[model samples]
Target chain A: MPFFEAVRLALAQIRVQKLKSFFTLLGVMIGVMFLIAVVSIVQGMGNYVEDAFAGKFLGVNTFNVRRFPDFNMGDVTEAEWRAWQRRPLVTVEDAMAIRDALPAGTRWAIEDARWLAAQSPYVASGPQALVQAVTPEYFAIKNLVVTQGRAFNEQEDRLGAPVVVIGTEVAEHFFPALDPIGKELRIGGLPFRVIGVLEKQGTVFGVPLDRQVLGPFHSALHRFTGARRGLYGVVVQAPSAEAMPEVQATVRELMRRRHKLRPAQDDDFVLESSESALTTWASIKRYLVLAGIFLPAIGLVVGAMVIMNIMLVAVAERTREIGIRKSLGARRRDIMAQFLVEASTLSTFGAAIGIGLGIGLSKLVAAVSPLPASVATWSIGVAVLLGAGVGIVAGIYPAGRASRLDPVVALRAD
Target chain B: MTADAHELAGLSTTGERQAVIGATGAAPGKDWVIVTRGIRRDYDMGGEVVHALRGVDLAVRRNEYVAIMGPSGSGKSTLMNIIGCLDTPTAGEYWLNGVLVSAMKDDELARVRNREIGFVFQTFNLLPRATALHNVELPLVYAGVPAAERKRRAIEALERVQLADRMDHRPNELSGGQRQRVAIARALINNPAILLADEPTGNLDSQTSEEIMRVFEGLANSGQTVIMVTHEPDIAAHARRVVVLRDGRISSDERRDAFVSKLAATI
Candidate 1:
C-alpha cells in the first residue's frame, strides 16, 4: 500500500475507536510526563544550589584554610595534630607577609575566625532576625553588600575598635523598625558599634548569611574574644581561575616559611577551594538527574506493557481485515507497517500531551512558589520520540502475529 | 460497439479463439480453467483427524458453470474453499489458471486468489460501515491499481451488478439483495478467471434467489467461468453442470443435457 494510504487507514481506525486509542495513549503520556517533570525540578534545584553558594562565599578562586573536613570519617589523630601543630599557624604577621609576597598579582589576603565563649542561644531582633560575626575582607571576598553603612577599616582594626557590622537579618532582629547602622550592643559584656548592615543574602545549606554580624578582626580578637593566641580560619583570593593552583601553592609555602616549620613537619590547616563547594553541589545534581532519567525509564517500561496489550487486542479484532488485506496481495511487511504505525501514532500523541502538561506544571510551580524552573527544547523532543519508539518496539509481537496469521483461517472467521 | 452475445462468446472474442481449441486439461492444459486430481483435505480437530475431502478428482473448463450440491456434512464448502485457493488440499495437486495452487505458500495463494478467483460468501461479507463504492473498490485497491483507475473499474463493476445508483450507500442502508449484489460486484471487480460463490442465494428469499441466479446466468454466458455451492437443487439447476458430493466424495456428476431432458418440460 502507499504510505499516505496506510496512514489514512490507521487514522480512521483510531478515530472510529477513540476510547481505546485514548486509554492506550494515556499510558505513554503519564510515562513521558514523569520524565519531563523530574528532569525540570532537579535541574532547577541544581541551579538554585549554585546561586546560594556563590552568594554566601567570597569565592573568586578563593580557598579556605580551616581546621576540619565536613565529610571526615573520624577525628584527626593526636600525633597528626602534634605533627601539624609544630608548624606555626596563621598570624597577623603571616597575613601581612603573604600580602607583601604577592605584590601586584594577588587581590586580597584576609584571615578571620570567631571564638564563642558560649552559644548565646543565637540572639535575635525584636521581630526575630538572625545574626553572625565576620571581618573586613569578608566584604570583598564573598561580594558582600552594605544595605545601609560601610565595612570596618584598617584604622578601626589597628586600635581594636569596637565597631561591628550587622547582617540584614541581624539588624532586623535586634533593632527592629529603627536604623541599626549606628546602634550599639553588648556581646561578651563588651559594647560595640554597629557600623554597617550587610545586604540580604539568603540561606546556604540552611544557614542564612544575611542573618549574621561582622566586626574588625582585632576588635573581636583582643577584647570580647580575649584570645591571646587562637586562630579560626583564613580565606585568600587570587587574580583568576588560571592562577588558582599557583596561588594556593605559593600561599601554603609562604605560611610554612613564615611559621618556620621543620623539614619533617606538615602544614597545620586544611586548604580547600571553591571547587569543593561545587563538587558537593555537582554530586547532588548528578544524583537528581540520574533519578530523573531512571523514573521515566521505569514509567516507559510500564507504558510499553500497556501498548503491547493494546496492540494485541487490535490484532485480534482486525484479524479478518488483516486476512482480507493479505488475500488482496498485501505483504507481511505491509501488515507490520500498518500495526506499528497505529501503535506509534497513539504513543506520539500521548507524549505531546504529557510534555505540554509538564511544561505547564513547571510554569505553575515557578509562579505560585519560590521554586526556579525552566524546561528545555531537547526534553520535549526526546520525550515525544521516546514515547513513539516505545510504542513501536512494544507493538512488534502483535504486528508479527498479524503478519503471520493464516489468511485462510482469518477469512473464515465471522 | 453494440455486439450481441454471439460476437462476445468464448472467453475473449478475438485474441485467443484459435488458442484455447489447441489443447486442454483432459488432453493438455489449455482447455481447463481449474484442474484437481486425487485431492484430499484432513483437519485436526483437537487431536482427532477428520477427513473433509477424500480423493476427489475434477476438471472445470473455461466458459463452464458448475454448481456443487450436498448436505451440510458432505464437504461442499470445503471443496469450494480448496477451489478458491483460500485453502490447500493435504494430499493432491490442484491447479487454477495453470498454476499449482497446492504447492504455493500462503501469501502466494492469496495473490493467486486476488488475480484469478473471485469469492462471494453466503453472508455477502461486505465491510459493514463501508459504502458500496469503497467495498467494490477494495480488491483493486489491494492490487495497487492507481486511484483514478480503481474508481473507474469499481464504478464499472458496480454498473455491471446494476448497483451504479447505490454506489455511496453503506451495507446497512441497502437491502439484503442489494448487499449481495455489492459483494458480487467486489468479487467481480478484478475480472478474475473464475467467480466462486458459496451459497450465493442462501440468505435471500426465493424471488431474490431467482433474481441473483439470473445475474449468475448472465455472468456465465459472458464467458466468465462460475462455480457455486448450494444444497437446493433448484439453485443448482441453473448451472450447465452439477457435481454431487456424498460422505466427503463425489458421488455423481450430471451434465446440462441430462438435466435439460429431466426438467425443461416443467420450465
Candidate 2:
C-alpha cells in the first residue's frame, strides 16, 4: 500500500482510540520531559561556572595558596582534614618570601578574609559584606579596578592605616547620595575611611561579587576579632600566561624552604590555579551530565517497554484486519511498514509534547529560582531522535509478528 | 469468450477435464480464468494429517458465473481459498489468469491476487472506521494507483453500485445492503479478472440478499468472471452453473437450471 495511506490509517486508529493512545504516549512524554529539563539546567550551570567563576572572579595567570588542598570542606577525608589543620598558616611573611623568590615582574598579595557586616553611623541599617584585609598590591593581583579615588598607598598599608576600599554594593547602601571614596564606615566595630570604591561586579553562584569591603591587612589583624587565629591566604600573579608554571614551581620551592620542610616530606601548603579549578569543575560537570542522561534513560527504557506491549496488543486486535490487507495484496513488508509507522507516530507525538513541556519547565525554573537554565538546541534534537529510536526498537518484534502472521489463519480469526 | 462455452461443456468428464487442464506447469489459454489439476491440500493438526482437498480438478472460463456449494466439512472453502490465490495447494497445479500461481512465492501470490482477483466476504469486510469511499479505494491503493486516479476510480466504482450519495458514510452507518454494495464496489475497484465472493449475503436479510444477487447478476452480465462459495441451494441457484462438493471432491457439476430442478425435486 501507499505510504500516505498507511499513515492515514494509523492516524485514524489513534483517533478512534484516543484514550489508549494518550496513556501509551504519556510514558515517553514524561521520560523526555525529565531528560530535557535536567540536561538544560546542567548546561546552564556549566555556562554560569564558566562565565562568573572561571572568567571574571579568577583572573588569568593567577593562583592561590591556601592551607587546604580542595575548595570545599566536605570533599576531604577526616585524616586529610586533620593533616591540613596541622600545617602552618599561609602568613604575610610567607607571601613576601614567595614574591622575593619569584621573577622580578611577578606580584603577590596576602589577605585575611572574613564575613563581617559594615555599618555607617549615618545610616540606620548598613549592608552586610564579606570583608577582606589585604595589602595594597592585592587589587593588582586580583584584577580589581577601582572606579573612584585610588587604592591605598604602600606607606598607609605598612603603618596599619585606617583606610578602606568599599565594593560597589557597600558604597550604594552606606553612602547612596554622597561620593563614597572619602566616607567613613565601621567594619566589625573598627572605623575606617573609604579611600576607593571598586567597579560593579556581578554575582557568582548566588554570592554577590560587589558586596565586599577591603581594609589594610595590618590594621584588620590588630582590630578584627578572628585575625589573630592566623586564617590567611596568598594570591600570586605571574607577569604573563607563559610564566605561570615556572612561577608556581618557584613559589612552591620558596615556601618549602622558608618552612624548612625536609625534601622527602609533602608540601604543607595547597597551590591552586584558575586552570586547575576549572578542570575540576569540568570533570564534575561531566559526571552531572552523565547522571542527567542516565537517570532519564531508565524512564525511556520503561516507556519503550510500554510501547512494545501496546503494539503487541494492537497486533493481536488487528489480526483480521491484517488478513484482509493481505488478501487485498498487501505484502509482508507493507504490513511491517504500516505497524512500524504507527509505533513511530505514537513515540514522535510524545517527543513533541515532551520537548514543549521540558522547555516550559526550564522557563518556569528560571523564573522562580536563582539558578540559571537554558535549553540547548542540540539537546532538543537528541531528545527527539531518542524518542523515535525508542519507537523503532519497540516496534520491531510486534511488527515482525504481524508480518509473519498466516493470512489464512488470520482471516479465519474472529 | 462466449464461443468457448461449447468446448468447456465438452470437457465435462473428470478424466476429460484433467486431459484438457493438463498437468503442473502447462500453459492455460486466455479464455480460461482458473484451472486446477489434481489439486490437494493437507492440514497437520498436532501430528495428525487431515486431507482438506483430495485431487480435485476444476476449470472456470472467463465471464462464467459459477457457485461452489457443499456442507460444512466438504472442503469447498479450501477450494475457494486456492482459487482466490489466498492459499497454495499441497500437491498439484493451479493456474489463474495464465499464471502458474501454485508454484509462486508468497509475495508473488500477493501480486497475483492484487492484479487478478477481488474478494467479497460474508461480513462485507470493509474497514469499520473508514468511509465507504476510502474502503472502496483500498485495492487500488495496493495496486499503487496515484491519489487522483484512485479517487476518481473509487468514486466511479461507488457510482456503479449506486452508492455515490453515501460515499462518505462508514460501514456502521450504512444498512446491510449498502455495506455489501460498498464491499462489491471495493472488490471491483481494481477491475480484477475474477470477483470472488464467499457467502456474500450470509449476514443479510432475504431482501438484502436478493439485492446483492442482482448486483452480481449485473456484473456477470457485463462479462466479469465471478466465483461464489455458499451452502444455500437458493443462493447457488442464482449462478449460471453449480458445482457441489462432498468429502473433499466434486460430487456434481451441472447447469444452474438442472441444479435448481434437482434441488426442488429433492425438497
Candidate 3:
C-alpha cells in the first residue's frame, strides 16, 4: 500500500469519529492556551513597568547622588551619618561645583530640597489633593505644563517668595472663581500666594499629578512646612537620547570623585534608570512565565500519557489493518512512520488552535482588566515544538506495537 | 546457517509416518503442485484434545479439480486451512512447488500464499463497505501492482466474474450469488496458482449453487487448479476426484467418474 493512501485512510477514520478526535485535541489545546496566555501577560507587564519608569524619571542623563545608594536601602554608620548630617546637605554650592566639573557634553543641572516625611494639606471640594515642593528648574527638567498662570522667576527665589503654584484641584476646591492664581491662601497657617496653576500629569495609583501643589524649595521648607533643611537632590537633563549614556557615565565618575571614593570603595549612591521599575514589574511575572512554561508541561505530560493510552487502543482496534498492510509489503518502519505522523498532526493542530485562542483571550483580558499583556512570537514557536515533541514521544509505543504485529496472526484475528 | 539447517531437518520430521501404499507405486512423474504427507492437526478445545487430522497423505497435480468431503469435526476446514497456508499443522509437511512450507516464517509464508493461492469462502467474505470493483482490486492492491495495471486487472477479473455492470454496488446491495462471484473475482485478481473454495455454495440456494459450480467447472476445465470442501455428495460429485475423511483419517479416495458408475446416480 502507498503511504499517501494510508494517510488518507487514517484521516478518514478521524473524520468518521469527530467526537473522539475533538476530545483528544481538547487536552492539548487547553495546555497550550494556558502557556501562551501566561507568556502574553508577562510580556504586557514588562512593557507597563518600562512606561511607568519613563513617567517617574524623565531626564535620560539624570542620576541621583545621595549618602545611601538607593532610597532606604544601603547602610550608613552612625558616625558617618552624623558627619553626613553636619556636612552641607546638597546645597546650591555643591550643585554649582558639580555642574562646572561635568564633561563637555554635559547639559543643564540643578538641585532642590525635599522633606522626606512632609504631609500635604489634603483639601478637597470634589476630590482629594496633595502638595509637593520643587525648585524652579524642576519645571525645566520635568518640562511640566502650566495651564493658566505664570511661574515665578529668579526674583521669587532671590527674595524667598511665599507664592505657590496651585494645581487643578486647588482651584476647584477653595476657589471655583476664575483667575484665582493671584489669591492668597494659608497652608498650615502660612499665608501663600498662588502664582500659577499646574496642569494634569496623568494618573498613577488612582491619584493625579494635577491634584498636587507645586512650590519653590524655600517656600516649602521655611514658610509652609516651617523647616530650614537643605536641598534633597539634584537632577540633570541631557541634550538628546544619544548623549544619555555618556552623560550618565560622566555624572557617575564626577559623583564618585566628589564623594571622595577610593579605587576599591563602592559608591554610596546608586545610578539607575526606568529599567529598575521595569525590572520590579518583570520580577513578579518572571515566576509566572517560568511557571507557565513548566506547569502546563506537567499537564501536557498527563495529556501525553492519555494520548499514549488512546493510541494504544486505536492500534488494538486496527490490528487487522496493521497486519494487512504488513502483508501488502509495508515495512515495519513504514507503519511506524504513518502512526507518528498521525500523532504529530493531532498535537500540532491542537497547539495551533490553543495558541490562537490564548492570544485572543490575553488581548481580551488586557482590554477589560488591569492585567496587561502582549503575546511574544518565540512563545508560540515553543508551544508548537513542545506539542509536536509530546505527540512524537507518546506515539512511539503504539507505533511499535503496530509495526511489530505478525501478518499471519493479524489476518487470522476474529 | 545453523538455524536454516535445523529448520530443514525439522521440516522432514514434521511429515507423518511412511505410507507404504503409495511408497513405491506413486509415480508422480508430472509436476504436482501440492504434496502433503502424514498431515495431522491437533486442536485443544478447553483442555480436551481434538485430533482434527490424523496422518492424512494427499497429492494434487496441476489443474486438478478435487473435493474433500467430511462431516463436521472431520478436519475438513483444518485440512483446507493448512493447504491454503492460512494455518500451520501441529505435525505435517506441506510442499507447495517443492518448498517445505511447514517450517517457513510468517512473512515468507505470506509471500508464498499471495503468490500461490486464492481463497473463496462460502460466506462470500467481500468487505461490506467496499464496492465490487474495490473488493476485486483488493488482492492486486496487496500484491503492490501499479495503480494503472492494478485497476485494469481488477476490472478484467470482475468482467470474468460477469459483475462489470454491478462494479459500483457494495456487497450489501448485491445478491448472494453476485456477492459470491465478486469474492471469486477478488480471489482471481491475484492470479494465484490455485483457487481454494470452502463450501463455496453453502450460503446459496440450489440454483445459485449449480451456477457457482458451473463457474468452478469452467475454471478447472480452463487449466486452473480448483479445490473445494463440501459435505454434499452431489457437490462432491461435480469434482473429478473426491477424498473422504472420517475420525480425522482418510477413509477412501475415488475417481468421481468411476465412483458414479459404480454407485447409483441418486444425487
Candidate 4:
C-alpha cells in the first residue's frame, strides 16, 4: 500500500476514537507545552538582559572597574578571592587618577550607590530607595538624561553643593502636585534641592531602574553616613565601541601603577564590559535551557509510554483486521509501517496542540506579569521533532508485535 | 454412478492406479491450477502432535469449479488454508500454476497469494470500517496498484458484481447477500489465477446463499477457476465437481449430479 494511504487510515482511526486518542496524547501535549513555554520565557529573559546590559545598565561603549567582579560571585576561586582581598579598595582618588591617565576623548565617573533605609518624603512610612553619590561626569557616563531642570555643573560637584537629581519615581512620589526640580527633599534627615529629574528608564530583570536619587559625591560624603567609606565603582566610556579595549588596557595599567603592583602581580580591580556580562548570562541561559528541557523530557517519556501502551491495545483489538490484511497480501513490513505511522500521527498531533497551548500560555504569562516572553522558532521545531521521535520510538515494539502475528492464528481470533 | 462421476473418480485415482503419486519434485503444468501430492499438516498441541492432514492428494485443473466438502474436524478447512497459500503443507509438494509453493517462505507465499489467488470468507469479511469500494480496492492495494488504476479496477470489479450502485455503502449498510457480493468483487479485483472461498455463504440465509452461489456460477462460467470449501451437501452440489473428505482423506470424488443424488438418497 502507498505510505499516504496508511497515514490516512491512521487518521481515520484517530478520528473514530477521538476521546481515546486525546487521552493517549495528553501527556505529550502537556510535556511539549511546558517545554515550549519555559523555553520561550527563558529566551525572552535572555533578550531582555542583553538589551538592558547594552542600553540601560551598562551602555555598549562603557565598562566598569570594581574591587570585585559583580555577577560571578559564586564562581570566584578561593585563591582569587584571597588575592583580591589583599588589594587596596577603589577610592575616589584612584577613580581620578585613572581618569587622568586615560586617552583623550574618554569619559569617566565615580559613584557609590546602595539601597538605604529611609522614610518617604511625602508620607510617614518607611521605604527603601537607591541612593547614589556621584561626580558631575556620572550622568554622561551612565547615559542618563535630565528631563526637567539642568544637571548640577562641575562647580556644584567641586564645591560640595547641596543639590540632588531624582529619578522619575522619586519625582512622582515626593512632588506629585508641584514641579520637583526646584523642590526640596530630605534624605537621611538632610535637606537638598532637587536640581534635576531624570527621564524614566523602565525595569530591567524585574528591578525598577528609575527609583533612586543622585547627589554630588562631595555633598553625599559629608551628609550620608556610609558614603565616607570609599567609592563603590568607576564607570568609563570610550570614544566608541572600537576603542573600548584600548581604554580598558590603559585603565588597568594606570590603576596597577597607582597601587604600586609589580608586572607579575594580579591587578586588584575587575574591569567588566558588556561582553563579559553577556557571556556569563549565556552560560546561565545554557543551564536554564537544560533544566527546561530535562523536566519536560520526563513528561515526554511518560507520554511516549502511554502511546505505546495504547497502540499495543489497538493492535490487539485489530488482530482480525490485521489477519485480513495479511491474507490480502500485506507484508509484515507494510503492517509495521502502518502502525508506526499511526503512532507518529498521534504524537505529532499532540505536539501541534502543545505548540498552540504553549504560545498561548506564554502570552498569558506576559500579559499578567512583568516577565517578558516570546516564542522561539527553533523551540517550535524542536518540539515537533521531539514529539515525532517519541512516537516512532514508542511505536516500535507494538508495531513489531503486530507485524509478527501469525495470519492463521490472527484470523481465527474472535 | 453417472458417466461424469465415473470419469471424475477415475481421474482422482489416476496417479494411485498408475503408481506415479508421491513424486516430490514433480511440477504441475499451467493447465493445473493446484496439485498437491501426499500433503500433510500437523499441529503441536503442547507437545502432543495433532495430525490435521495425513497425506491428502488433490488436483484441480484450470477453469474447474470444485467444492471440497467435509464435516467438522475432517481437515477440509486445513486443506482450504493450504490451497489459499495461507498455510504450507508439512511434508509434501504442493504446486499452484506450475510453482512449487509448499517450499516457499512466508513473504514469498504472501506475494504469490497476492498475484495468484483470491479468497472469500464465510462472514464475507469486509472491513467493517471501509466502504464497498475501499473493501474491493484492498487486494489491489496489496498488489501495489497505482491509486488511479486501483480505483478504476475496483470500480469495474464492483460493477461486475452488480454492486456499483451500492459502492459507497459500508458493510453494515449492505444486505448479507450484497456483502458477500462485495467480498466476491474484492476477491476478483486482483484477477488472481484461482478464487478460493471458505464457507462463503455460511453466514447468510438460504435465499442469500443461493444468491451468492449464482454469482459463483457466473464467475466459474467466465473461465475463473473456483474452489469452494463447505460442509453443506447442497452447497457442494452447486459446483461442477465435489471432493468429500473423511478422517483427513478424500473419501470420494464425484460430479455434481452424482453427489446430489447420493445426498438425496442419504436424506
Instruction: Note the DockQ of each predicted structure.
Output: 0.43, 0.73, 0.19, 0.75
TM-score against truth, every candidate: 0.80, 0.91, 0.71, 0.94
How far residue B146's Cα lies from its native spot in candidate 3, in Å, is 5.1
lDDT of 3 by residue, A155-236 (tens): 6765678777766766766676557667775555566788888876655434455666666655643433332354446666
Superposed Cα deviation of residue B253, candidate 1 (Å): 3.8
Q: What stretches of model 4 exceed 4 Å from their correct place?
A: A73-87, A117-126, A368-371, B1-23
| Best-matching candidate per TM-score | 4
Q: Model 2, range A363-411, lDDT digits (tens) per residue?
A: 8887776557899898899888988888889999999999888888889
**Model 1 C-alpha lDDT versus the unseen true structure:** 0.74
| TM-score, candidate 2, chain B alone | 0.94
Q: What is the DockQ of candidate 2?
A: 0.73
Q: Could you tell me the TM-score of chain B in model 4? A: 0.92
| lDDT tens per residue, model 1, A233-266 | 5667777888888888887787767667787877
What candidate 2 keeps of the native contacts, as a fraction, is: 0.72
Each model's C-alpha lDDT? 0.74, 0.84, 0.70, 0.84
Q: List iRMS for all predictions.
A: 2.2, 1.0, 4.0, 0.9
Candidate 4 per-residue C-alpha lDDT over B158-231 given as tens digits, one digit per residue, 9 for 90 to 100: 99989899999999999999999999899988889899999998999999999899999888877888999999
| TM-score-sorted candidate list, best first | 4, 2, 1, 3
Model 4 Cα displacement at A405 (Å)? 1.0
Local lDDT at B18 for model 2? 61
- Candidate 2 chain B minimal-lDDT segment of 10 residues: B6-15
